[model samples]
Target: MNPTLRPRRLRQSAPMRRLVAETRIHPAQLVLPMFVAEGIDEPKPISSMPGQVQHTLDSAAREVERAIAAGVGGVMLFGVPEHKDAVGSGADAPDGILNRAAAFLAERFGDQTVVQTDLCLDEFTDHGHCGVLTAAGEVDNDLTLERYAAMAVAQAEAGSQLLGLSGMMDGQVAHVRAALDAAGHETTAILAYSAKYASALYGPFREAVDSSLTGDRKTYQQDPANRREGLREAILDLAEGADIVMVKPASLYLDVLADVAAVADVPVWAYQVSGEYAMVEAAAANGWIDRDRLIAESLTSIVRAGADAVLTYWAIEQAEWIGARA
Candidate 1:
């Protein structure tokens, strides 16, 4: 073997590997996705996602504090209301659970952590769709944009520093951005779920949010087979004033994530969605894989694929692990 080509030399020691490592996962690059449920007396376990829970309002606040203590960069909040309606009216109501949770977190953290909200209607809609529906039972794109705009202002007024626009609606970013600016929320940011695919990987998430969705969201969300389309969506979001663009179910869409990251002018994020997390957890629980190592490897792979940040359920735990290793 040529001595100069001995790559194993760097891999021979832990310190050498660390020094030569090309990709690293940092606590500051991780964002935790949390759910706060209305009418919950305690943190309720999501059966599909073991070790994950839907927190009560008070518990949600404490979880945010814990995430901050663990050094995670931010928290993305989702609200599960006790009631639902055709138009998802609660989503934009100032007293809505999600809005109240956002207000509480922003007030308590006060710039100590980035408080983000899920600026979508799915959790509040009785039909479990992301937007308003038409008479023909289809998702009304233009009409939904109006609802999204209203929701954006509500979330911003509730003190969310960043809005995770995950509804996959057409013109959603532009609408939300304009509404925010018009409402004097100029500093609020939008983290667009630019390339969210209509994947079966969202099963656990449906449970986490107690989704009433009877059918699929394929009409709105991107198709998993189209890589170029994902990039196009990201580009559109960037042009529409998204501060960051994201690809959901990151492990299954590394190529898409990479493409978005390459063309994105701002930060590009990837979401390790519910199903991805559940698969790893199930395997680890059954002694089929190394839990902590797999978690670290998955996140590192996402970073290596060019994501600037990752939204993951294991964020806090993984952040602590990274800190211990450092």
Candidate 2:
């Protein structure tokens, strides 16, 4: 350990530190998550997630254009329907908000960017479960699979390039994949929510989608404590022909994201969930932190942990900042 071998040499200048950085985060590696509500004449602000809105079709398209201009990788669309049913019929209806929004983005963006849709029923179902329910008032796993398969076909028909199976239902990847293939949509890929946990970090998203969740998702989503369990979920998803696997609430679960990325042969993604964004914004608003720097740091950490892409509310904003830097 000679004094001349000290790390201070490399840390002597900002440019030197930048050159030695281990992970790189580009605007093109970020995906923006957007919400489109049916029957909304004007964009409705989500109070829980400040600056986020449930947009009308036109506004949604405008936002996508802005994101594209900012150089983001893609967008993940969520629909907030004007109606809900026990079976979540809107999830498969051609006229559903999600279906129509996907079509709009596809027709506008084409191959310029990837168009993904959130393949979940929470925003469409009356009870706010991500699937069909049983008479016993529980989420029926097998029944949900059927509904998800139908939803997948509907999304693919609406021009969704990738379907994000965020419900955490068992066998969902296989069911959706089979349905897409049967419908001759062999190119429609599946992004499996492999390590999604039942977390409090989803509060803002629930408000954004106007969720009616009366109970927790512990029955379907993974437990937060088990790292090995996360790996197991990724393996199952990969076996079911998933093109990508994801870990939700990325900041709190980087270790889990790392584990999933290690074994997943396909691309691995991480969702920087609503709460994560809110906390950073809140702290910055209070002048307790340097917001822009922290945002870049948080996103870079996820990339450093091996996430191929990150789903974030800050995608467009971050992309703009990156563009400015460039």
Candidate 3:
């Protein structure tokens, strides 16, 4: 095979390939998403997500410590309350599980790692919708914005450095930012889930959070068929004062992530959601794929597609792997 150029020259050795790698995954670019369940005596394993648990407050703190030691960039905390209400009042209560977990992490490792909280009502809502419902049972976008603002302030007061607005409410970023600044938390950051799509990839996440959702979220979340809409959402979030923009279900939405990253002035992130993790684990358990190698490859592809950071279930373990190689 004669050729003008041999690309194999650079792929001849491990060192050569690594040196010429266009994308690199690092420990500091990975964020761990954790759940702290209220009234639990111990961490409860999520059946759908193998090896993942709904942690108690104490267990969550210890896990954060370990993640910091592993050089993980940050942790995004979600709270699971024992009770749920129509308006999701627990979401803004100072004594709520998520708020308490945020405070605990901040007090122990505030300067050690970035402490972020999910500013959505779904986990705390009886109906399992991300926001309050109207008389017609439709999601009330304006009312949800108010709830999100209050939740943002509560999370900020609990020392969350970043608020992850994942509710898919209109003007949520602007409303939350205004509320934070009004509460004298001007420095607190907003990590908006700008391009979240209503996809089947969220199945495992419902089990992890014990969600009660009876229907879909297509009314608010972006449609999977629209790529341009994802970019528009990112631009809207940036204009609304979002510090970071994220695309959810990363593996299936790498194209959206790339488009968002192209024009985003702020950091762009992608979430390798629960279902994605579960599928990999399931395949690995069946001896179908190399788990470690797949993890590294999946994350590297997200980075190569233009994600500045990734929220992944494999954060801690992958960080350790990177460290081992280094």
Candidate 4:
């Protein structure tokens, strides 16, 4: 190594390293995903997810206030309906748990921070699939589009600024966008879960939502083995007018995240899924790792991989850490 070109100078001090850092995580770049369930009088702990819980409407609102106070960029809401049906009728019901909670948050906290919703049927459906199924139990792509389009309007009416299309149905983004425009909710944006993978990391999530999944989502969600497909999905979603695009299971898919970020004209985001969080918590519980340090590093790694924003369970805590450090 050339002594004249030594990089050690920048590493000599904390302030010097901070000054030369290429990537930074911000409170506004973190979005916390919340689960609000029906029939729950109190916040019910999601055992698999450790500290997370199925919050009631009022409890969810209070939690959102804390996240907003910490300067988190947004909160993504997932509804857990008490009732499940073949067509997931509760998904678009005006008074359904999800819509009810969404409205509650939007009315009170919309001005304070971004309010987003998971516009999928998994939580409301008895089959536990992301969309409606046919007689043979195969997911009906076109049929699900109709449901999603309706859900879009419903969520928009409930004041969701961003709709997270995580179902992975072909043409979902386009179909939902057309429906929103026709319904006069043109400003409601789509955050396409463009490269959501059929990863094993979703096990804790299913528990959190009380999922009664019929089988698997492999038929819709992308396979984790394909690298190019991730970017292709993002491109397709962008063509369909997605306002923002996301890659799920962030840590393991940095290459894909980078590929999408490199070419995307719109903001690119990543989801640090449940399994990833669980692993760290499990390890930290065993005293194998520093819990807080690993959490911060995990988030920093995702942002460094080209995500403009990150959907993380630790968003609020991360923001507080940032605030304390400042």
Top lDDT hit: 4
Off by more than 4 A, model 1: 1-4
Task: Tell me model 4's lDDT, rounded to 2 decimals.
Answer: 0.94
lDDT of 2 at 257: 94
Candidate 3, residues 86-174: lDDT per residue as tens digits? 99999999999999999998999999999999999999999999999998999999989999989999999999999999998889999
lDDT for 149 in candidate 4 is 97
Please provide, for model 1 over 1-326, each residue's C-alpha lDDT reduced to its tens digit, 9 standing for 90 to 100. 54767768789988998999999888989999999999989999999999899999788888888899999999999999999999999999999999999998899995799999998999999999999999999999999999999999999999999999999998999999999999999999999999999999999999999999989999999889999999999999998999999999899999999999888899999999999999999999899999988998999999999999999999999889888888
Q: Write the per-residue lDDT of candidate 4 for residues 1-326, one digit (tens) a residue.
A: 55788878889999999899998888999999999999979999998888999999889989999999999999999999989999999999999988998899999999999999999999999989989889999999999999999999999999999999999999999999999999999999999999999999999999999999956789899889999999999999999999999999899999999999999999999999999989998999999999999998898899999999999998899999999888
**All candidates in order of TM-score, best leading:** 3, 4, 1, 2
RMSD of each: 1.0, 1.1, 0.8, 1.0
Scanning candidate 1 in windows of ten residues, the lowest lDDT window is 1-10
Name the better of 3 and 4 by lDDT: 4
Q: What TM-score, computed on C-alpha atoms, does each candidate reach? A: 0.98, 0.98, 0.99, 0.98
* TM-score (C-alpha, index-matched) for candidate 3: 0.99
Q: What is the C-alpha RMSD, rounded to one decimal, of candidate 4?
A: 1.0
The lDDT of model 1 is: 0.93
Off by over 4 Å in 3: none
Runs of candidate 2 with Cα error greater than 4 angstroms are none
Q: CA lDDT of each candidate?
A: 0.93, 0.92, 0.94, 0.94
